[model samples]
Target chain A: MANVPKLSDPQSELLDKVDVFIFDCDGVIWRGDSLIDGIAETLERLRKAGKKMFFVTNNSTKSRAGYKKKFDGLGLTDVPAEEIFSSSFAAAAYLEQSNFPTDGSKKVYVIGEVGIGEELDLIGIPHLGGPADNDKVANMGSGGRLEVDPDVGAVIVGFDRDVNYYKIQYAQLCINEGDAEFIATNLDAVTHLTDAQEWAGNGSMVGAIRGCTGQEPTVVGKPSPLMIEYLESKYGMDRSRICMVGDRLDTDVLFGTDNGLKSLLVLSGVTSEEKLLSPDNSITPDFYADDINAFFASETATV
Target chain B: MANVPKLSDPQSELLDKVDVFIFDCDGVIWRGDSLIDGIAETLERLRKAGKKMFFVTNNSTKSRAGYKKKFDGLGLTDVPAEEIFSSSFAAAAYLEQSNFPTDGSKKVYVIGEVGIGEELDLIGIPHLGGPADNDKVANMGSGGRLEVDPDVGAVIVGFDRDVNYYKIQYAQLCINEGDAEFIATNLDAVTHLTDAQEWAGNGSMVGAIRGCTGQEPTVVGKPSPLMIEYLESKYGMDRSRICMVGDRLDTDVLFGTDNGLKSLLVLSGVTSEEKLLSPDNSITPDFYADDINAFFASETATV
Candidate 1:
């Protein structure tokens, strides 16, 4: 029932008006490690046409520098570190902007992976309990109490493959007992682990802490204005001239439309045409396309 | 503001009318490993008065045999294993009654401790992924797709000390992608790990899966009526004559009142006098007592 238009033409008026294009990397640019067809050339065309590019991803498992390495590995060698905005980097940026305590007096308790910790380190925010506490088990026997460190000012929960009971319990204790700020890099329920299947995302880990603490985390990812606010503040970009392009509706499209940016939904990833056109689908993107390659399809066809 | 009367006298009419007492172990009989004062004498007195006692605990970490061992270690040598009804046992009983596959055509995937697995094994319900999967990390690297076992018919989530990302992901895959039944032992948010502190309970673990699957689990523990249904079916006890005694308001008190059983709230566990008296407290027990010891306080005083 959605009245979204298909962006088939390379010279579409919507594409012409957009000064900046904010893209979600995993689904839009590539599916797993394989880059989408014509995406590299489309980016080259967009850049030649004087459009600013920013790759925004809710994946908190990798830092901006780490993301740059992934980009390089994936043959997107020109994608600068400054243009890559990961949820982990946004978390660190949000904390820095909020004037969070960076000294040894107070630190962050990470319920995530190395990426979040690495970003925190970049911002000079002291932290503990990420990969370091992954193997640590809770002593539930006699005289077993998870000791709460008095120095934890915030608990940053992100996508962690190493998430366990000890980290979950420790995060819960820090938030409930220690009165630490609860922050989630993203609340994405599931993410595509590969081209084959979807896996549990950071939201699952955040849900555990939220369950015990009876608290809502300040989400620093897409659909949450925190990441956009960070981007806008850092780059001074015009929101009206920016178009957000991605595959997912709940995070990517909602992130764009909610924040006053135009959104384009691509069918090359998790979502399909049936899903987009479904009556039950609440979120409607401004524009729909077969894929990001649709941007410069005419030129590619002519070639 | 609750009009619950104090059960101060042994000759109280409510105590005399009850034939069976369903007690929650953690906050009712003991705090951690240390037994509450006079609980032993209280149980003995109740037994002498021809009252049947059953300890119903949401703690899924221990099986019935394990609980019996703990009871004997705590000097309650007379307490039998048959009288102990843990959530883990309730889960097995529920599955067996429901006629779940036990001939190995389909098995259960446990997102809990050994207790749940042990109970499943007792009922001849084949299961996998408990403490054995504790050290197993999810392969988030290339070609990392969580291989869902085709034999998994149900995913049972309990209070697991060894809960990890791999187990959580596998359970989600089983329920979401594999069409397996989602079952939770209990959903208690926080439990008394010690008298000094409350730790994240089974609900926290359940919450993580709930987040990813977007599915409500069939809870088998307190207040769900599943445990009582299992108990009633097994023991043929009259619900009206049974009194549920526990320290917690949500699980124990709610379980009793919801199941048409007389409820007694003990102040010795998680719920304090201030909490019980608060207008915010919605759950109201039929009677309140200092502890189970209050049952024969006058006799103890004389001694």
Candidate 2:
């Protein structure tokens, strides 16, 4: 609840204490298919300064391997697949953590794309009800009824391009049984892709199931503390030494501030400094800068 | 929000004043393919008493012609297609009321089945977007981006069995254009067909677009005054002489009470007298019966 500090120049004095740096991918490091100016160089310098790096994203449409390819496609070198944590992978990890039946007996009725399917496959979890044969179910009975898969013990939803009434019907029936676990990748309403306009995000699919079933999902994406929790458990990183940087205050900044981590807002993506300082927004960052490059430029001046 | 009256047996005095009887089909007339016993005879007697008959339903998946076919399949006699006021048809009527361009220059982007498409076609209203190419759009780009048709001036949603991300994405963009009218058939959360479990209704699809775009739709189904407005304007129905008969409270009964029309609740399908009279529920009907047969049994006594 502290007043947002003016981030004219970030000091290495603050960076020297940071052991882990979590970067939001889409708006922080890159915009559309291009990287922000001087961001790659800034990451390189941060790496040389012994700062551990992790890329966290709420985009559940891609798997970790796919994210790695996206990183490689953008010429972001030295980032292995393990260093990337996507919401789709976070959902897989959440199910695995909850011991979703891996005995080959129970399966997760997935309502997402291949990204969610791949993550579940990597974690040795069985799944059914994917994006395959969407039209077959679409043209079914008047009520859009489908036979129940008795083996479905969980219902997981992400960014499903093939979201149909059949999937919502089946998922509602499964979750309404009162035993299946419901998990959502994120609740991001709109995703900003180019500069044209905003598009509906994964939450539309997640919310469709929620609206039908009236059941709350355990969200596993940004600002949920699941990604940071995964990083802590996997790498044993101290929360106090972690610094979060991103363009959105709701997801990236809120994720850091809510967890006692230093959060910075960059103006390269969705939100702006004027909007953040506006009376309508309650979420505020500890610091603000033009972009990651601008934030890093201040670090060089301090050095 | 008045307290629900305890209705044991309806008075024939109320029936004597009734001229137009609006019945909800799914639960009141029949429960999925079988007519309630003696209901056809009751309709015959009512028609003999000079009462006009109309069927109003929130089931948007079927066109009025399709509803007539369904009525014939159930062996219900003497019902015409013009007397059927379905949500799909109502949506068409609503657009026609608004003077939506019929010049073929303006189009309605539909995110529903052929039922909705057929109604628009019958009215000679130009429209695009049907369930035929659902999968083609489903397998399009990863982000499910479709070029916004410049001619689209309205977006209509009903019970779309083929509700995909592309439909929602395109619909959201069209509605976000600030000039396109957003219309939903009904916002029923779940469609109860066989009573085994809950299946998602049009509300699931409508709510998805609402959640994504933060826009409210002009609902045209039960509980909305648009249906009553349509009947009043088209058939010149007198509200005082109209009686709405249905099994559900929130939709069928509320629609009647909201407009000062006498409401009757039957217990054959969804809402029970126990639930209606419960302190938790606010929607109430002026009369209650075991089923349509029971109501007709009382009518015989009056005769």
First chain TM-score, candidate 2 = 0.91
Q: Considering only N, C-alpha and C atoms within 3 Å, which residue pairs clash in candidate 2?
A: none
Clashes of each: 0, 0
- How do the residues A37-138 of candidate 2 rate in per-residue lDDT, one tens digit apiece? 888788887788788888988888789998999989888868889878888899999987777877778888888878888999998888888776354453
Encode model 2's per-residue lDDT on B1-303: one tens digit a residue.
436554445445456778888999888888877788888888887788788988988888789999999989888848999889999999999999889988887889898888899999998888877686576553243353457788898999888766777788788788876478899998888876545556788878887887787778998887889878887897788899999988888778888899999988888888866787788888778877788766456547777
Supply DockQ values for each candidate: 0.59, 0.38
CAPRI verdict (incorrect, acceptable, medium, high) for model 1: medium
Model 2, residue B297: what's the lDDT? 66
Worst 10 residues of 2 chain B by lDDT: B136-145
Docking model 2 quality class: acceptable
DockQ of 1: 0.59
Residue B22 C-alpha lDDT in model 1: 90
Calculate the i-RMS of every candidate, to one decimal place: 1.5, 3.4
Residue lDDT tens for model 1, B114-140? 899889888898898999998887776
Error of 2 at B140 (Å): 5.5
